[model samples]
Target: MVSPQVTNLAIILVMMQVSKQVPFDNPDVLLGVRALYILSNLIILGIYLYIQGKINKKRDMTTLKYVEPAPVGSGEEPRPVTTTVMEYDKQQLRQLIKTQMMGVGMMGVMHLYFKYTNPLLIQSIIPLKSALEGNLVKIHLFGKPAVGDLQRPFKAPQGLFGMGQGAVKSDKASVENAEKNWRGGVKEE
Candidate 1:
C-alpha cells in the first residue's frame, strides 16, 4: 500500500497542476473557489458530527489499556493509559476534529489574510478527503468491524517513512513495564 505521505504528495501535485489551469485572477473564479472551500469544510465537519452522534448513541464501554510512548528526545518515560472504548473513541474523534479545525484556521489565515487563492482551491478538497478516509469514519460511520488494524486503542499511525514502532503499546510486558515505571519511579531506558 502507498504511504499516506506519498498519496498526499500525489494529491497536492495534481491539485497544483489543476490550480495552474484555473484563473485565480478572475474575481468570479476566485469567489467560486472560496465558496468551494467553505462548502468542503462544512461537509467534513458534518461527517465528524455524524460520527460523534454515532459514538454517543452506541457508547461502547469496553475497557482499554495501553502505554503511550513519550515524546521523542524528551527523555520522558512512557505513560500508561486506561480508558473505556467509548472514551478512547471520543478522544480519537476529538483529536480528528481538532486537527481539522486547526487546518481550517491556518487556511483561513493564508487565504483571507495572505490572499492566496491557489491553496484555497487545493485545501478545499484535502480535508474532505481525509475525513472520508479516516479510520474512525471507517469503523463508526461505515460500520466496519474494528478488528486487526482498526482494533480498539487503535495502533499509532506509522511515521511518514515507516521509521518507528507504534507509540501505543498494548502488549502485556510493555503495559506492565510502563505501569511499574509510573508507580515506582523506575527510569525507562
Candidate 2:
C-alpha cells in the first residue's frame, strides 16, 4: 500500500486541479465552499472529541516504556521514555489537536485575510480524510488492535522522500541501555 504522505499528496494535487475549476470569484460559490470548509472542520473536531471521550473511558494505564530517538545529526544519545498508555494517548491527542488548530489558522489567513479561496475547498476534504486515517482514530474509533503499525510510540513518521529514519530504539536492549545511560548521568548531547 502507498504511504499516507504519498496518498495525501495525490489527493492534494487532485483537489488543486479540481479547485481550479471552482468559481471562487463568484460570491455564491465562495460562500458555499466556505460553509463546506467550516462544516468539514467541525466534523473532524467532533470525531477527535469522540475519540478523546473513548480514550478517557478506556483509561488504559498500562506502562509504556521506550527509548526516544535523538534528533537527526544531533550527536545525542536516545533518551528513555516512560509513561502510562493513558498519558501517551493524551499526548498524541494533544498533538493532533494542536495540528488541527494550526491548519485552521493557516486556512483562515489564506481564505479570510489574504482573500485566497482555492485552499478553502481543498483543506476541507484533506483534513477530514486525515482525521479518519489517524492512528488514534484507527485504534479507538475503529477498534483496531494496537499492534504493528498501530503500536505505541508509533514509528516516527517517515521524512519527506523517505530520507529521515525513525530509529526510535524501542527494542528491549535499546530501552535498557537508554535507561541505564540516563540514570548513569550520561549527558544526552
Pairs clashing in candidate 2? Answer: none
- The superposed Cα distance between candidate 2 and the true structure at residue 113, in angstroms, equals 1.9
Report the lDDT tens digits of candidate 2 across residue range 102-138: 9999998987789898888889988999898889999
Tens-digit lDDT track of model 1 for 1-189: 876667888899999999999999998999899899999998988998999999999989888889998888878778999889889889999999899989999998998899888999779877887788788999988899999888877777776777765468898899887888885766658
Model 1: which residue pairs collide? none
TM-score of each: 0.93, 0.92
lDDT of 2: 0.88
The alpha-carbon deviation from the true structure for residue 125 of candidate 1, after best TM-score superposition, in angstroms, is: 1.5
User: Residue 43: error of model 2 in Å?
Assistant: 1.0
Clashes of each: 0, 0
Candidate 2 segments whose C-alpha is farther than 4 A from its true place: 183-189
